[model samples]
Target: MTKILTTQNAQITTAAVEVKTLTISGKQVTLSVFRQLREEPLLTEDVTLNGVPWGYVNYHPDKCGNHRRHLHVVWQRGADLLRSTVYAPEVAKFQSVWAKLFIEAAIAEGLTKRSAESFGISKIQIWPHWATHPHLAEFSYGGVSFQAAIREDFADAYDNNYVSPYVKEKAVAITGPHGDAGSIAALKLPVAEYLAVWDALTALPHLFIAV
Candidate 1:
């Protein structure tokens, strides 16, 4: 037996892990904690404005064996990748404190521009947590319209027809903006599933609406 010397065998034991997203000017900054790792906890974060990458950080444990925790930085530096070494005995505690400081540093970098709404987002509507409703955001990409709305069914009395309740509670739908079925690629996905897709889309050069 080789004993399988790998960090993948570890597990995360945190009570709660929440994703914190910030909208500064028109840019979007996301802060997420991964306290579920078996060996150590880390913060995975990124920042984008106008569909452009301002900064990003990701933890790679397998490369350094949890001693010299490797934090990868994603930004234009003429190179594909670069890393910074973080040596902290108390890995979990260090990551929690580091996340806050990193956010401050990102704000000071002066990357946040105006609001995404102010730029060129007319069709999509973005609703934050503070708002009465919790619709994340909705917009069209390449003529494929997408919307994040409450996952409820129509009530009785709409032409005397009752719609069936959704099997999964919350979800989003992708369709054509104005009933163009020919070129429309309609899809409905749970909020959790769709949000991940939205996050990946933000990495593109002009896809992220910034709202």
Candidate 2:
């Protein structure tokens, strides 16, 4: 066999190996920091990193980190996420909205494709373990048309539906198949579409009526 090397092969391997850098930036800013409205909007995604549909939980212990707490979310890999309401300082709070924002932000940042869903496989997903410990949040779907069975059917009503099978350290994770190129694309999408997705995700909150 003749040994021939091409630069294109290396690029392909690099892209496949890296996938995309998901940087969930941890914020240490003082509460004095004025909450800034999103200067830039994001795109809502139907699936999470593990490819499962969005769902809600009530003050569940975060599976990503330890000795701490946070909301279970699938927001952009490296983006900073801030929400509307929170009570305690160390107690982190979030909802499925954060998950929607994460996907939208990825698209807005030019990290995802227009039809990224075409290439992505539906599977369960989880937030980072080291950074976010068990989280505490409440989720309710009343205004939005959500099928309650969706979450239960995903993992046969398993609680650890988002856990990764590769992660043996976490004893409570589900199984699923995935491609390296889930949504991140070699090409870019229009800004309008990006904003539209973000808007779409915001509508989710409306589905919840105050109890």
Candidate maximizing TM-score: 1
Runs with alpha carbons beyond 4 Å of true place in candidate 2: 1-85, 100-150, 155-211
Model 1 lDDT tens row, 21-77: 323455553332221212311123221112223333344434445353323323222
Provide C-alpha RMSD values for all models, in order.
21.0, 20.9
Q: Write the per-residue lDDT of candidate 2 for residues 20-56, one digit (tens) a residue.
A: 2212234332322322312121223232132221221
Candidate 2 displacement at residue 142 in angstroms? 29
Give the range of the ten consecutive residues with the poorest summed lDDT in model 1.
167-176
Whole-model lDDT, model 2? 0.26
Colliding pairs, model 1:
11-38, 12-36, 12-37, 25-114, 26-114, 26-115, 26-116
lDDT of each: 0.29, 0.26
